[model samples]
Target: MQTSLAKSVTFNGVGLHSGAPVRMRLHPADADHGIVFRRIDVIGMQNRVHATWDRVTPSKLCTLIENEDGVTVSTIEHITAALAGCGVHNALIEIDGPEVPIMDGSSAPFVAGIRRSGIRFLRAPLRAIRILKPVEFKDGVATARLEPADGFEIDFAIDFTDAAIGQQSKRLEMANGAFVRELMECRTFCRQADVDHMQAHGLALGGTYENAIVFDGDKVLSPGGLRRPDEAVRHKMLDALGDLSLAGAPILGRYVGNRAGHAMTNRLLRALFAQPDAFEYVTLDADQERLLPGAGVCRPVALAG
Candidate 1:
């Protein structure tokens, strides 16, 4: 069955890149409404942006989508991840700004809000993209690939020179509330030098020690360092899930990323669709539905101890 929120949920915060204050609300939609983002602040142009791979614009920093009229929204990964992780099929995200708020740099706040708003099942069948062949995209050292799998899975690896986050890798079956328990609270991280560079360039202006994990040489500059020893990689996996959600349906495939970021994942999606033989859309069966990321997950749980 497809699902939608039972009521509206609202969020307020600053955009990680723009540093602008924004108000966003998630409202329930009818079945097949999919996920559409409306720019409430836009005056007259087409304000509705569909959350789909084809709508993604190239950005090295975060996932961004634009409507035909050139209205765009950035940093939407967290909330989209929350929706996909919760098995929501349709929603209308209304935002009075150009970016979704950073919100502690994690999806936990979104997940918690979604759980509190509750999920209402729509009387319609759910569909998923089933990988039929391996599809991969690569740029320099970064790579993103998708291959056949019985259930959704994510395997990610990251290597950085900073001693605080040198090398990390993790793989998990993202089903049965695994995203909520394992990945939702992992915060976005960046090296101190990168933060300085981005801020100098008028980007990541809203990023603070409170919202994003900051690494300086061998030290974690964020307070209460290291939620998990492999948080950097886990967050990468969380990000991959968000980018994949842009596919517009649940995916029954294993995604593997190596130093991959938003752009590479979007490229992989383009590659997958370019060759129709790579994937097929199918109405999910009971067994297949149970294997999806949000299967049987009713409420958010406390972070693992």
Candidate 2:
């Protein structure tokens, strides 16, 4: 069965890059509505932007979506991850600004909010994009791939030049609330040099030691260090899940990424859909539905310390 939020939930914070104060509300929508973002700040224009891959604009730092009217919402990956992680199929996400709040730089806060508000099932049958064949895309050292699988699973690998965050890899089946429990709290990270560069370019204006993990050479600069040893790779998986959700439906496939980012993942999706024989849409059975990422989630355990 498809699901929506039981009630509306609101969040307030600052955008990581723009440093603009913003508020957003997640409201329940009827079944089949899918996920849409409404730019409440815009008037007399098409304020609604579908959270689909085709709407994605070219961006290096985050996942950004824009409408035909040029109204855009940036850095949406965290909240999108939370929505998909919690099994939310339909929602009208209203934002008063151009970006979602960078709450703790991870999906944990959004996960907590959704768990608190709870979820309600709808009477519509759930549809899922099931990969039938392997689809791959690559750019230099970066690569992303998706292949047929029984359930949604993610495997990611990231390598950084800094000694503090060298090479890390992790693979997990995104069932039984694994995303919320394991990946939600892993904050976004960057090297000290990158932070300096972004600041010089007037980017990451809201970034501080508190919102993101920053490392300098061998020193850990982000206050308490890491929540997990391999947090970098885990956060990459979190990002991949969020980007994949733009498919406008839950996906049943195994995703593998090696140094892949938003643009690479979007390209991989384009490749997947371009080959008609590569994928198929299917109505899930009761048992299959139960095993889906959004079905077996254990909210309490997911948010527990």
lDDT of 1: 0.91
lDDT of 2: 0.90
lDDT per residue as tens, model 1, 32-119 = 8899999999987899999999999988899999989999999989888888888887999999999999999999999999989878
Candidate number with greatest lDDT = 1
Each candidate structure's TM-score, on Cα atoms with residue i matched to residue i, is 0.97, 0.96
Looking at model 1, residue 252 earns an lDDT score of: 93
The stretch of ten residues in a row with the least summed lDDT in candidate 2 is: 296-305
TM-score of predicted structure 2 = 0.96
| lDDT of candidates 1 onward, in order | 0.91, 0.90
Q: RMSD of each candidate?
A: 4.0, 3.5
Q: Which residue pairs in model 2 clash with each other?
A: none
What are the per-residue Cα lDDT tens digits for candidate 2 across 1-305? 78888888999999999999999999988889999999999999999999999999999999999999999999999998999999988899999999889979999999888988788777888899999999999999999999999999999999888888899999999887888888999999988899999989999999988999998987779998899999989999999999999998889999999999999999999898899999999998888876566665623222111
lDDT for residue 201 in candidate 2, whole number 0-100: 100
Q: How many clashes in each structure?
A: 0, 0
